[model samples]
Target: MAHPERDTDSAAGTGGDPGSWPARQAPGARDLAGLDARICRCRACPRLVEWREEAARTKRRAFADWDYWARPVPGFGPPDAAMAIVGLAPAAHGANRTGRMFTGDRSGDFLYAALYAVGLASQPTATHRGDGLELRGVRITAPVHCAPPANRPTPGERDTCRPWLARELTLLRPTLRSVVVLGAFGWQAVLPALAAAGWRVPRPRPVFAHGARTTLRAADGGAPLGLFGCYHVSQQNTFTGRLTPDMLAEVLRGAAEAAGLPVAHAD
Candidate 1:
C-alpha cells in the first residue's frame, strides 16, 4: 500500500526538516508509562473500537466460532535493547489479541524467523508476550498502538497516537543504537520523530527496499543511529515472494552489525 518513493510532503504536512513540526515531546518518562496505561484501555475512537470488538465476537466465516484477540497490542522485546523494530500496526487477530507486536500473523512468522535465525531472538515462538521469547538487544513496536478497522488506521488517529510512539523512543533513548523500519509507514512515522528530536535525515530519505541501510545523526546528541529499511513480510509479500526468508535474514544480519552485535551468516 505504502511505497517509499511516494512523496511524503502531503502525509507529513511539511517537506522540510521535521524539527519544524509543532508537536512537543512527551512530558517525561513517566508520561510513557501513563500512555501505556491509556493504550491498554483506550476507547478514543468509538467506531474502530466497536468494529474490533465485533470482529473478535464474530467467528471467522469459515471457522464459525474461533477465538480472536481484539484489543490493544503492546510493544515487546528486551527492555535494554539497542535496536527497535518499528512496524505499522497489529493484524486484526494477531497482535491485537496476543498483546505483543508482530505476533500470530504471516508477517510475524517471517519476521520472528529472521530474528531467531540471526540470534536476535532466542525463541521462534511469539504466540504470546510471555512465551519466554527474548530479543537480545532488540525491541519491536508499531506506529499505531491500536488495531484499526481493516488493518488501516486513519491519519488523524495515527497523529493522535503519535505521542505514544514518541514517548517510547524517548524513554528508550541513549540505549537505542539503530532502528529497523519494516515498511514505508514505519519509516514515515519515525522520520518526523527523528527530525523533531533534531536528527539529520538521510539523503533520499530511507528507501523501503529490503536490506537498505542509512546512517543518521541523532538530534539530541548527534550520535549516529543506523536506520535499516525493509519490505514488510506481510501475507501479500511473503506468499507472493515479494519478501523472502533469506532476504529478510540478510537485513537482520546487517542491522545486527549496525547495532554492534555479533552477526551470524545464514545457513
Candidate 2:
C-alpha cells in the first residue's frame, strides 16, 4: 500500500554521498558500538529517568519475577542496514521489561509476525533479548529511548532524545535506503533529524498518512532515502482493526522491496 515514490534511484544503489557516511565523520562514529551502553546509562531527562526507574521497581504483577531494563532501549539490528523502522518510544511493560524494542509485548507480537511473514525477521516472536529473533536487512529504532508516562512523551522529552536517533541515522546513511515510520509522532520526529543529519527535506515537508511515501537525500550529493508511513501497531489499533495484519504486511513488504530486500529467502 505504499505510495509510488517508495522506490527511486537512490534506493537502487545510487544513493548515499560519495563518502557520505565515512566511518570517522559520522555522528559519534567511534561510539556506534558503545552507543547502546551510553544510552542505557543516560539520565538526561529527570522526569523520564524517574518514571522508568520507578516502573522497574514497582514491577507489574505479571512481571514481578522479571528484571526490567529500566533504561534507554537502543536500536537493534545490523549497523549497515538498508531499511529501518522507527517508533515513538518504549512501552513501559514491553521494551522496558525485555530491553528490546517491542519485545515481550502484544504490539511486538503483531509486528514481528508481519515482519516474519515477509522474510525480514528470523522469528515471529520476540520473547526476550536472547530469543534469537533476527532481522535480515532492517533495523529498528525509536525517537525516544526511554519509556514515557502514559506512553506519551512531552515535546521536550522527544527533542532531548532526538540526538540518539540522529546519530544512528548518520551512521546508517551509507546503506539505509528506506525508513518505515510506525506513527505520526515518529514521522514528525524523524524528518528534522534526517535533515539535520544532512538528508534533504522538501519545502513544506510531507504530510503523514497511512501508505504515504516520500523520497529525500542525505545531501545534494548524497543518496536518496525513501520514507514510508504506517499506522502504529498499538493494541488499540490492532484490536480495533485500525491496523490489520494485511495492512502491516503491505507496508513492510513494500519497504523491504524498496530497500532491495527479497520477500522470501531461506536463511
Candidate 3:
C-alpha cells in the first residue's frame, strides 16, 4: 500500500546541481519523493521488517491507543536546505510510531529545541508529522530507517542502508554546506556514504569528538561540505549532563555559522 505522504512524482530530492556527476551515476538518480515512497515500502532486511512490525503491533504501554507508523522514516525538511542533521536511527516508539524523524522521543526533544533556538525549526516540539513543525535551513536523516533492537544496528544493517543516505546527500549537494552529526556512530556512517556519493573525504579520516569539525570536497570539484559533530541527544547523555541543552544549542549555532546561515544566538 502507498503511504499518505507518498507522492512519488513530487521529486524534491533531485534538484541539486549535477556538476561533474556522470550522467549514469546512479546514487541520486531518483527524486526525493520517489525515494521516500520506495523507502517506506522497503522490507529488504527481514529482521528489520520483523522487528519494526512487531514494535508497531505490540504497542508501548503509554501509547496503547496510538496507531504506529511501522514503515521506514524518510528524511525531513526542504530539499534546498543548507545544513543537514545526521542521526543514528529511528526510535521504535518515537519515529516508528509517528512516521516522522525525531517525533515523540526525548532525543528529538533535545534536538528540535536546539534547532528551534537557532532559528532552523519553527517550533521545538516534534510530536508528530503535520504538527506544523517546520525547518528552514536544515534537514534531518538517519542511515538506518527502521528502529533497531536496543538502538543498535549491526554492521550488515548499516551497510545495507548506506546507499539511501549516500543518494540523499548527493541530491542535497548543491545547497547543503554543513552537516551536524550526532554521536560517533553517525559521524562514521556519514563519512563513507558521502565519499561513495562522489564526495572526496579526507584521507586518514577526521576524528569524531564532541564539537569536532571537518570538511569534505566533492569528487567533481564542487564546493566543500562542512561537518560538525555533537554528542547524541539520547536520554543517557542529556540526563547525565554529558549533553546539555545549552551544549546542543552551541553546536547548532556553530553549524549554522559554518553553513553560512544567518541566525543569531543568545546562548
Candidate 4:
C-alpha cells in the first residue's frame, strides 16, 4: 500500500485522472529545517565539540577554512519511511565538512554504491545534501551526529545523542518498520532506545553480529519493528577483507526480504 518511490499523493484523488490535481510534492526545507533546528547548537558534550572543531580547524589548511555545518547531522529520508539505516557518525572531511551525512568523503563512496545497487539511492555520488539525491523508503542517519576524533565517539557523547534518535524515530511513528545498524556502536545505541520504547531486552541478549536480525514490538503493540546489523564498512573491514561487496549485498538482501520488499541488483 505504501508506494514510497512514487508521488502517490498526485494520483490518490482522481483515480488515474491526470488533471484532477498535481500530486503533493514531498516535504521540503521547512520540514528538514525543523529537524535541523533541534541540534543546531547542541552543546550536550563540550569536550566532543571542542575536539570536533579542532579537527575541523586542523583540516582547514586543505579545506580552505570551508564553512562547515559543525552542527549535528540530521537524518535524511522520507518522513514516512519504514526502514532507517544508522551509521556510526559523520566523517571529518565528509559530513563534518559538507554538513550532510556520508558526503564529501571516501567513506561514503562504497556506502552510496551499495545504496544505489539496492535501489535506495537515486544518485551515484553523494557530493553534498544538495546534490538532489533522495532515498525512497530508506533513511540514513547516525548515532553520534558529529564526527569524533579518529571516528571514535566517547560513551558519554553517544549517550547524550541518543535522545535525538529517539525523538526522530518517535516522530516517524507508524511507518517505521525496521532499523539497519552499521556497527556495534549503533547496535548498542538502539538497545536503550528500544528500552525507552518499553520493549524488554532480548532474553539471550541480542548479539551484534554481521547479518544479525531481531524484532521488538512497538510501544503501541502493533507490528514489531525488525532490526538488522551489518559490518561497518570502514577502511579496516574492507581492506582486510572482513567484509566483501558480495557479503554486504547478501546481508542487505536479507534485510530487504525481511522488510517484505523486492531486492534490486546493480547491472
Q: What is the TM-score of each candidate against the true structure?
A: 0.82, 0.88, 0.89, 0.82
Q: Which segments of model 3 are wrong by more than 4 Å?
A: 1-29
Model 1: lowest-lDDT 10 consecutive positions: 1-10
lDDT of 4: 0.71
lDDT of 3 by residue, 103-134 (tens): 99999998998888888889989999889999
Model 2 clashing residue pairs (backbone): 15-223, 16-223, 198-218
The reply for model 2, stretches above 4 Å from the true place, is: 1-26, 29-31, 265-267
What TM-score does candidate 3 reach? 0.89
Q: Estimate, for each residue in 211-250, the C-alpha lDDT of model 1 and write its tens digit.
A: 7787888766656888898898788788999888888888
Error of 3 at 211 (Å): 0.6
**Clashing pairs for predicted structure model 3, backbone only:** 13-32
Estimate the overall C-alpha local distance difference test score of candidate 2.
Answer: 0.82
Model 1: lDDT to the true structure:
0.70
* lDDT score of residue 132 within candidate 2: 87
Question: Per-residue lDDT tens digits of candidate 2, residues 79-159?
Answer: 889999998899989999999988988999999999998899998899998788898999999998889999999888788
Could you tell me the C-alpha RMSD of candidate 3 in Å?
Answer: 6.0
